[model samples]
Target: MPNITFHTKHIFSALLLFLVFGIQAFSKDIKQCDLLIQNGIDAMWEKDHVKSLELLTEARTLAEKNHWYKQLFLATNNIGANYYNLLDYGEALNYYLESYTIAVKHLEPKYEMIVLNNIAILYSKKKDFEKANEYFKKAYDIAVENKDEVKIGLYAMNLGNVANETNNLKKARDYFNESLPLLKSNPQFEILAKMAIAENDLLQKNYNQAQVTAETLLKTTKDLNYHDIGISLLMILSKSNFEQNNLDLASDYAQKIFARKPNLETKVAVFKLLSDINQKKMHFDLALQFKDSIIKAERELNEINNGRAFENNRVKFEIENYKKEIALNEAQLSNERKIFYSVLAIIIIVVFFVILTLRNLSVKHKQKKLIAERNEQIISLELEKKKSDNLLLEKMISEKETASLLEHEKLKNEIEQKNRKLSAKALYLSGRNELIEETLQSLSKLPEISNNNLLTNHIQTLKSHLKTDAEWDSFITHFEEVNQTFLNNLKTKHPKLNANDIRFITYIYMNLSTKEISSMLNITAEACRKRKERIANRMELSSEIPLYDYLSTL
Candidate 1:
């Protein structure tokens, strides 16, 4: 007993030591993960993108290994930012999407808004204004739903920018106006919104208003040393003055933009404005020089855009491969976990049965004769009990079969009732559509209705509503309840059958006539018959077999 106790104490001590070491190792990994992430962010800020990616990738690996979602989100989002800075928009979008998925699944809505905004910015950079608008609107809606004032202000600023780019000046003004108050705490964003409003005025050809606004912001930018904002204000001032025929002032503002060392896009705009200003001033040589500079800047911009386009397609394929790899890893991990649990359960069950068997074997010798006598009596009782149990089981099974049959019959009746209701609904929709079509035809034949725009629009609206799918959807719901396995069995057997083919097959299954189906589907009877044959051919069924008969068999 002492030896057993000593061995148990040793085992417990080993387990305790292992647990302590495991905890230490886990803490070490967390600390290392955080260190790597912080270092990666520093590298990104320092413009060492390659080093940033390396460190962040290491952190991502560690975070994923330990299921650290927050660290993973940060790492992934920063990786996207790095790619974005490099003009690899496709790769940036891919990582942003990954982080977006992680945020949606494991993090808060605020994180989701961050990734959504990043994705919108990528789309905006790629000149996909429509998609950019969509994502920006989505992020804005989320911010509104969360009542996050900061996010609301930020996203509102973004939406305003998108609206201005798309030439929706009124909408841009509204968004800016909405954001300005909300972003009062954020001076930078407030200035950005004010700048956007100035740009909006310029775009709308309100030259006086634009010049006044830009001049006011120009002083604020100078006072705050906001060089980038100052450059933008200069461009707005240059354009506004040029439009007002203040050529000398425009030239001075454009030249100031050059001194600011603005980005290539801003430089291109400035060069174009300078060229136009020189041309208006009758300085042909100077205009030609500025035009050449514009050409060079535009060529560089095009190269960057083209590079982004190429990377977009390349990264699509890369992301697909990455997804496949992730799926495979998850599958392997799941299989490993299942195997571990299965082995542990088997070990426990085997140990329990072995101990029980050994205990039984140890008692068998002393109780051998008595056990034999008891076994005889037990066998006699078991024989009697088993016979009685068999008889009861037989009776129970008979009763169960009767109950099952009654339940099945009742279920069948219910299904039949649902099918009848579904059929009636389909027929009613068919008749209603037919009636609307007849009314439309009659209306079209009337000269008074055909000549008037209002009447014509009403007729078109009626036609649009005539072929509504809502009733068909309701019918399908009832039909599915009545024939639950039919669609599944049909799909399993005829995998190539499309949705339209399935809908036609469903009508045939419900025993609806061809004319009824045609009216319900807004097609002719001949088309319906052809569709039926086409579906049968797609199913690879023999032409000799009727479609309805084949369906009934299924």
Candidate 2:
């Protein structure tokens, strides 16, 4: 399960708004407390509830008890969120209920939705479907009443999650689809909704659609540097690919998942996928390896559980009781034995048992010697093999080093030549820019070019005169192809997404400022902003994330 995080988007926006308005305003009285609260929230996200509770408790105590409603509410919510992160549903329930009481009494609409939604999440996590749906409905109603567009989708998504958990998949799909239209241009929410939809598709046996959805999400999220979502998307795509019988792609994705440095469950899932792949490949040896992996995973879980399940020295008690049972039986037998003949027969039996034991020991000693001799011979051969392997490895390394040096020298010469070529190409680019400027200078100078085909042909002819003629042309063509592919892919994954939206996300992914993107793309700031806004509208990410953030999300 992915860790749920608080959206500090509100805080970030607050800061941005201050800058935009040139508000050299005084900080709020709760500034320290607010920072502490944020810290507590961050701690909770990292699952450090103890620290979160401590910080929240301090903040609550510092506030005016007489007017403690807001402080109490925030504290309770923070502590409850911490417990929720810790998966302590019972405790989390207690704290959230306290927070909910204050929100209801105070009628703080904003805080009310936050608390209610959190409670709903807790209930959902607990699998209390009835209660989960109840809180979700309440929160949704509040969001509607308050016209809180942001909170609305959260409520809907929460409901979708519950519906999914309860096998109300149709309802889940409906909920996700409903959010889709409302969240069209919002990259972050779209990612979440599509992820849910992708999961739903998988459940419905819509492997192809699910695969496309997951792959698109993986590529987008990976570009955005959203590590958490990227892994999830990759995992989903890997499974989808596996289902589609795209074994090689599935194997590649599975291997990436394996190398992802994941937690236990992720590793287990990856191992299972690999096991499946190997089984299909008829690699019985590798398939069996997953059995061992499963065992190891289970053992790790068991080790954690065993601390509470059994007492130390449990086996010793069982062994001692068994000895007592044997002794009691022997005493009873002694009482039943009545004559000298019985004693003589027992002695004869004991003697035979001892002689047989000795004979067996002698035979085992001879077998041991033979086994040791064989092992010694094997060890000697292995040693020779190891020596041969080391020698071969040394030779390979020497050859590799020699080749690397030669390649390095060759690359140095190529770089020197390429630099000169690129210098000439730069002059050509400058000249082309001048030509284009001159062409636009007068309508009569447009030449015979009427459309893209004419312009492309003109460019081809112009390319033949450049210093790095072929290379420049090739690079330009490749860039055009990649750029077109990027646009098409974005549009395909996001049908409503426009060029502005693509540029916005691209900027975010590139971590470029508006000025920087404008400079690079040779556009004005206003034009760039318009493009980003267009992108935002298309991607459905109008707020909570800016164009840059949205693009970064891609």
Candidate 3:
């Protein structure tokens, strides 16, 4: 094994990270669990799975007690995340679902979005792009609602990756660009920056720029130890060198990939590249041997390994799920036991209270009997003995209090009326928003969004809300109409396209640029561009018109 030494300056940086997390932890209790979860996230970003579990376990333990749904959600998220790093997708997905279930229970939109984003990421990895896109878009909506720039940025990055995988470089660049501005000083963010820049430069065929950015990533990822991305960067760098005919540099990079991964697939590619280099150097024997080795390795790597790991994980997951069910049952039994004990204690307390009350009632009954006996004497002396005048005073006080309460009731009714007015306004706006969505659907059924007078009144009503200065709630109904009418019309025209596909095309033909399309649709620009290109290809456009220009013609 090669002792790959990276730069040693990361110790101080690691300490600084710890200190930052520690300070956040010290500032408050329970409320700062999000900060703890953030630390766990940083650990995951650094590829320190062991540390990730430690922080996340501590964070998850307090989730029920703390209001930090994010912390609890992230604890489950990190567990799956670590499994993902290990390439154990099944376990990762299981944990991801556990987190998602908690988010649903809490009705927390933000963490629910994270679960959705991660699910999309996993599906994409599994080559289920359709499902991946669905999940990613759902997550993007919640992220937008929460104004979480970080999550939006990550969605862009992942969408770019999906674009890159699908051979849509133009779209990939757009998505990467959207993410670049939002990532701050995290190690993972730095790698993503390099990756996005790499995608952009590579798409433009700016080999030098790509090489420089990739090399910078190589330098920074020492303590980060993200070997998978590092190796991919190396592969691209090698490809760039090979394209530029720098065979010596290309050979060095190929060697790095082989050394880092050493898997059969990588070895075959590396061996082929080495063979080419050696043949160029007139080392015929070495080249021929590499070629032979590549053939044998190909057979072993492709046949013996395919689906083997996945099947193993499926079995493991099933077993673990069964165990979890048993544990849950045990927990329920324990809870039942606790409830039984509690009920018993309550019954004992009730019995004690009842005994005391019965004794008091008996004494009261005796006192009442005495009062009954004295009633006749009191009646005889009633005129002379105005000694119980205190009782009359109590009656007068009660009457005065009732009158005061009646006076206050009038003010309460006025406040209730004001609240009712506000609530009515809210319900009106909600109903209008729904109506606009229906209108948008109708508009989309036609070739163009209808500016016809039928909707003129509805749009006017919505605009009136803005005059009342309900900024956030205003314009929502109008946009809903725009979205629905325009989209539904397009779907009617093109029934072959799915809901997502129709939305993708509607935005394009509406003169929305690729970046705007991605942002509005909560997709990566690369995805938007690719989807557009795909639609254009399906329609069989010619080179005489650009894809977007042709889409406008539609």
Best by lDDT: 1
| Model 2 agreement with the true structure over 1-554: per-residue lDDT tens digits | 02112324655887799786653332344666677777878877886655666677666554433355787688778877765654446657888998898889985788888888888878776678889999998998898898877678767877887888788899999989777777766667768888888888887778889888987777667343343566677777778887888878888887876555776657767777887787667564576577458556645644543432222113223323443444455445444543343464556456445545555676556545645665565566566556655754665576556556545644554443443333333333433333333334443346565565867675566445433436445544443343455455666778875444443454444354666555444456799778776666666665776555444333
The TM-scores, one per candidate, come to: 0.56, 0.46, 0.45
TM-score, cand. 2: 0.46
Best by TM-score: 1
**Following a full C-alpha superposition, what root-mean-square deviation does model 3 have from the true structure?**
27.4
Ranking by lDDT: 1, 3, 2
Please list the residue runs of candidate 3 whose C-alpha ends up more than 4 Å from where it truly belongs after superposition.
Answer: 1-79, 82-88, 94-98, 101-107, 137-141, 212-224, 227-230, 258-269, 275-288, 291-554
> Candidate 1, which ten residues in sequence have the lowest lDDT sum?
312-321
How much is 287 displaced in model 2, in angstroms? 3.0
Q: Tell me, what's the RMSD of every candidate?
A: 21.7, 32.6, 27.4
lDDT of 1 by residue, 54-116 (tens): 788778877987899999999999989988876766668889999999999999998999999
Relative to the unseen true structure, what is the C-alpha lDDT of residue 351 in candidate 3, on a scale of 0 to 100?
47
